[model samples]
Target: MDISGAGALVTGAASGIGAAVARRLAAEGAHVVVADMQEEKGRELAAEIGGVFVRVDVTETDQIGEAVAEATRTAPLRAVVNSAGIGGAQRTIGRDGTLGSAHDLAAFSRIIAINLIGTFDVVRQAATAMSTNEPDANGQRGAIVNMASVAAFDGQIGQAAYSASKGGVVGMTLPVARDLSASGIRLNTVAPGLIDTPIYGEGREAEEFKAQLGSHVLFPKRLGLPEELASVVLEFLRNDYLNAETVRVDGGIRMPPR
Candidate 1:
């Protein structure tokens, strides 16, 4: 996709990875929509990126529809980055000491709703707009990037809901790619390990965590920088052939059992 003058929608754009992706897309000359529930932050982020801000609660399909429609109406929709998600430490057993997600259905349902379902909502809508576009000379259309996590593969103790949400994202890559093939749109996922993002904290002591993560990687032992993730993201856009695979931006972090 030619990012220049193209439009993009990024969920969870108020902070962290989503914010980074949004800023980067704007820098690349894409008209970006900062979709987030936090209106104040969303507005500020939009100002910073010189993009539009759409107040959205990704868990609701109606809000997703409104955001996408509004963004598409303004600019040429070419890319979508699904980055809205939550993380927490909750065991399969609820605080009530019950077993299975069935025992804590509400909690599990919320996680899946905001993460997996929300991601799909944006992707579906973005792809719809992308397909409507007249393809480029090579029949290329658009790109959708789904944010997953290493937890999808090596979830530790008490990571049940968050892990399951991300696992679904990882699981959907191939099917989504196949479904979008006819439209000439590409789909891929990015499973980031630990990163130096606000989801942790701005600049706390990361040495111990870096050391722990280094043991799992073949390269430098460190939490990935947001730029690292952005690099891969831009690379995916540049290489139209890349699709249906989840790129691990982690520095070999297999995650230790907690």
Candidate 2:
């Protein structure tokens, strides 16, 4: 789909991969809506990109709906990138060996709610808006790119909840694409490995952690940049035939059990 002069919404757009994507889309001439919980940073980014900023909590359906509505108010919504998610680290069987110390059900549920269910919610609402738009030359109305993780395939130790949530994203990609095919909306996923983002900390501590993770990568012995992931997302958006696929943006790394 030609996103130029159209509207696009990106969740978690305040920082990291989401920020990179919002910037890229704006550069490509799309009117970006930076939907994120960080009001300060989101507004700053929106101002920088000449886009709109919407405070959004992905887990809240009404908030997502509002964001989508705002995105479509100016131009026909053409793209959505669901990059809002949280990481969790807890073994199913805790090292404490206490029955009450197992992975907290609430925590697991929260991760799934935000990562999996939240992604679906945004896609559904965004697709609803896109459906009203006149189809492009390819009969395409919009494109959706979801954020998954390498953990979904090769989850390391203590990544039960994270893996499960991301796995659900990978599992649903094709089905969602099929469901939206009739509307000329395409859906795909990008699974990143050990990316160097704020989520992993900063300074010397983060460098050391990245070094450790980078050692596992097959080549380019370094952490993947957020921009690298954003590049892949752009490909998925521009390539109309690249639907119902999950592309791994890891640096050829198959994470080993921690």
Instruction: Quantify all predictions' global Cα lDDT against the true fold.
Output: 0.85, 0.93
Off by over 4 Å in 1: 94-103, 202-218
lDDT of 1 by residue, 126-149 (tens): 898889988887798889899999
Per-candidate clash tally? 0, 0
Task: Assess every candidate by TM-score.
Answer: 0.91, 0.98
Best by lDDT: 2
lDDT of 2 by residue, 1-258 (tens): 788999999999999999999999999999999999999999999999999999999999999999999999889999899999999898898777897989899999999999999999999999989888899999999999999999999999999999999999999999999999999999999999888889878899878988987888998888899999999999999999999999998889988888
Clash list (residue pairs), candidate 2: none
Indicate the worst ten consecutive residues by lDDT in candidate 2: 90-99
Per-candidate RMSD, Å: 2.6, 0.9
